[model samples]
Target chain A: MRLEPIANPGLARSAGLPAAAIALTVVVASLLALLAGADPLATLGLILKGAAGSKFALLETLNRATPLIFTGLAVAVAFRAKLWNIGAEAQLYAGALLTVLVGTQLGLPGPVALPLMALAAILAGALTLLGPVLLKTRLGVDEVVTTLLLNFIMLLFISMLLEGPLKDPLGMGWPKSEALPRDARLPRIVDGLRLHWGFGLALICALGTWVIQTRTTLGYEIRATGLNLQGARFAGIPVNAVMVKTALISGGLAALAGFSEVAGLKGNLTLDISPGFGYTGIIVAMLAMLNPLGVVVSAIFVAGIFVGADSMSRAAEVPTYIADILLATALLFMVLAIMLTRFRVVRG
Target chain B: MDLIDILLSASFWAAVIRIASPLIFATMGELICERAGVLNLGIEGIMVAGAFAGWVAVYAGLPLWWGVAVAMLVGMAFGLVHGVLTVPFGLSQHVVGLGITMLATAAAYYAYRIALPEVTTPPRIEPFQPLDMGWLTDIPVVGQALFGQTALTYLALLVALATGLVLYRTPLGLALRAAGENPSAVEAQGLSVTGIRIGAVVVGSGLMAVGGAFLTMSAFSSFFFEMVNGRGWICIALVVFGAWAPGKAVLGALLFAGFDALQIRLQQTGLGAVVPYQVFLMVPYILSILALVLMSRRAEVPAALMTPYNRGER
Candidate 1:
């Protein structure tokens, strides 16, 4: 069988394929649930109810999705330029570390400290990614491996600092940073709601990313560079410069996830601030087809599965890892579905 | 002990070989995949699956060798998923590989939870025992280090040798190399490029699974989450460090394992009190990045490494 590219796919074919992919994922999930000796339909129903059945659950999902949105945007932006920045996990840690340092040491007023904390976080994340991007552009190294290796390195660096200089004195033996003061903490989105302003910031970032991708010259250059490097170079786009710029933006965006998790949610930095949000961001970006606007929906969707699955695992006696398996299957099937939208398979 | 004493000790050298064993199997696995023009980023996840599958198989009363075979079969199954998507569907190898990794890892974890729902501590099994060469074992540091390891370690060395021999000395190897280097040429020769590439990935993935099995069945007696921890990624770097040659790749693994063993020993020395242990743990990853940068300019990557080939496409 050979796949032939379709000149133009109709809207129904494009949309229908993704819908079919989701259905396939549901089928896979059902089979897994059956194998685990649970009522498949009830398990799925419980997941759906647990995700958005109550205001608290919905709020929980929004809180979980805040970091994912940032990381998803980061991945989407970087992947658009073909930079393949897989070190968002490292960059997130850098941001969190810087946020904690600024929050604990600066002793500034709330209005002044919060923005400063964000700025520091962005700078740290950007700097973290800059090393790998520079290596890729200058040394012809693969950013995928370099960035990935940095994740382990950054984790160890964080562990060292936490155990040594950054160790919290007031709290007995825990390897955690000092709590961010009330002033440094992020305000809630609403007075009575459980959600924080981080969710709002994530939305704003998603919108800003959309604008940058659609209405800006840098965005055009990024798409051009990703599509064809030599062609973009011949067309007078500064390919290397664009890649570096994309890295800065992507890294900075991913770092915001750390900043938000530290300041908005946890009010302190811990080793486990992210439950693989950086990695999950890749799934979000791909599920959204790398579209900036679509990241919000995908992030929320991914977060809902995790949140729902966590609760479902408690009530249903199933492992919470079902969330991961579901999302992974969704990502694979979705990519294949997206491919099929533009191509038709035919026996040669 | 001081640095020199640690270096001279047979235990340290044995530790190096033990650490290098998994890397050897995985590196050779990755080498074959890349040589056939598929990146197989699913290696990390596949290794995780292999580790879990092998341990669980043993825990379920299968023989140790049978556990190893089970791991290989599971690894190949994942590989087939990777191969089908990247080779035939022509999806982005990067996305598909990561997806596979996530899927395999999640499935393994889920299976573990289902299999041992109430167990807090990961259950341990009897692991591979070291071979005794009675007189050889008495011969000093070199003898014990070389001959005292479990059978899996020896198998790792033998696999590396076989990989070198098969890749450089066989027609099948030539076809696999051509699939990566010049697919059109292989197609012109009437050989199935798709078949050769997929076959390489399947076989290579089986070896990678064995690497993971070594962790459970030899290096450690129990399976744990995060056991495979970036070893698969490091193997990818080792491939570049070795310039895609099997012999050099095995050497790269040994060199890395040497650094690893030295760091573990250093953590117990006087210097361990001054420098944090995390810093020592950081050495191998930092070395991998450095190795990539150092070899980047000189290393000749397979020409069609990440590109997907469509029939009749220029």
Candidate 2:
């Protein structure tokens, strides 16, 4: 079998293939449930019900998706420029560390403190990624391995800080940071709602990212650079400058995930603030095909699976790791499906 | 003890060799894949799966060697999936690799939970014992460091030597290297590039699994979550550090493991009290980055690495 390029794929093929990918993921998930001796249909139902069956569940998912949206957007932006920033986890931690530092140390008013915390977080994250990006641009190193290695390095740095200078004085022997001041905490979206303003910020950022990608000069440059670096260079585009700019934006966006998690949901920063949100962002970005608005939708979908699976595990014998397996399957299948949309498989 | 005294101790050298064993296996594995023009980022998860597969197989009464075989087969299965997507499908290697890692890791964890539901602590098995070299073991620090190790450690060193010999001496090695450097040339010779690439990935990934098995079967007696840690990623760095050569990669692995051994020992010294334990833990990762930066200017990466080759495209 060989693949032949399609001249133009219709809307049905484009839409149907991704839908079928999701369907395939569901089928795989069902097989896993069967392996565990649980009823597949009931297990899936439990997941969906636990994810959005009630107001609390929906709010929980929204809160979880909040960080995902930030990280997903981060990955989407970096990948669009072909920068290959796998250190979103490190960037997120950078943001979280700054948030904790400023939120706890500074005694400014809410209006002054909140924005300052975010700015510091963004700067920290952007700088965290800038190191690897510079290494790539100057030394001709591959960003993928450098970025990945930085994640481990960043976590160790965080651990050191937590155990040393940043340790909470009030907490008994636990390695955690001090809680953010009440004024620094993000207010709920609605007075009675459990959701924080981070979700609202995520939506705004997604819309803003979409606008930037579709209606800006920088976006076009990024796309061109990604498509053909030598061609873009021949066309007079500053390729290295574009990469640096993309890194700053991507790092800043990922850092926001850490900020929101600390200042919005969790009051204090800990080593486990992110349960692989940075890594999961790659899945979200790939599933969205690097589309910013699609990242929002995909982040919510991914978060729902995690939240749902967590709740479902309590009720059924199936482990929550099923969520990871399902998403991974979806990501692989979706990429293949997307490819099939533009290429037709033919028997030679 | 002081630094000189610590370096002179037989125990320190033994730890260095022991730590280097798994890394040598995984580095050689990664070296093969990169040499064949495929970057198998699934190394970490593949290692995890191998650790679990090998340990569980032994726990279930399989012979230790059979357990290693089971781990290799499991690694190859994941490798096949990765090879299919990245090769024939022409998908992004980065995306497919990370996807494979996530899938493999989750599947391993899920299977473990299902297999042992009630155990809080991971169960242990009788791991490989050190071979007795009689008087060879009596020869100062060098003796224990080189000869007083499990069969797997010797196998790791042998694998590294074999990799170097095969890559430099064999016809198959020439074709494999050509696949990475110039696949069109390989195709011109009436060889199927796809088959060669897929085979390299399969075999390379099998070696990576054995590296992981070395953890459970030799280094430790039990399998646990996150046992592979970031060792797989470190091996990728080692490949670059070694400039994609098997002998140099083995040296890189030894250098890295030496740093690791020193850090562990340093933690017990007076310096350990002055510095945070996390600082010592950070040394290997930092060294990896430094190694990359230092080698970046000199290293000759496979010309066609990460590039998907489509017949008749040009």
Q: lDDT winner among the candidates?
A: 1
lDDT of 1 by residue, B97-192 (tens): 889889999999999999999998999999899999889876777877799999999999999999998888999889999999999999999998
lDDT of 1 by residue, A181-264 (tens): 998999998998989999999999999999999899999999999999999999999999999999999999999999999999
Distance from true location, Cα of A144 in model 1, Å: 0.5
What lDDT tens digits, residue by residue, belong to model 2 across residues B1-314? 48988899999999999999999998999899999999999998899888889888999999999999999999999999998888777788899989988998899899999889889988999999989999998788788998899999999999999999999999999999999999999989988778888888899999999999999999999988888878999999999999999999999999999999999999999999999999999899899999999999999999999887776666
- Show model 1 residue runs off by greater than 4 Å: none
Q: DockQ winner among the candidates?
A: 1
TM per candidate, chain B: 0.99, 0.99
Clash totals, every prediction: 0, 0
Candidate 2: lDDT of B55? Answer: 87
Which DockQ-derived CAPRI band holds candidate 2?
A: high
- Flag regions of model 2 displaced more than 4 Å: none
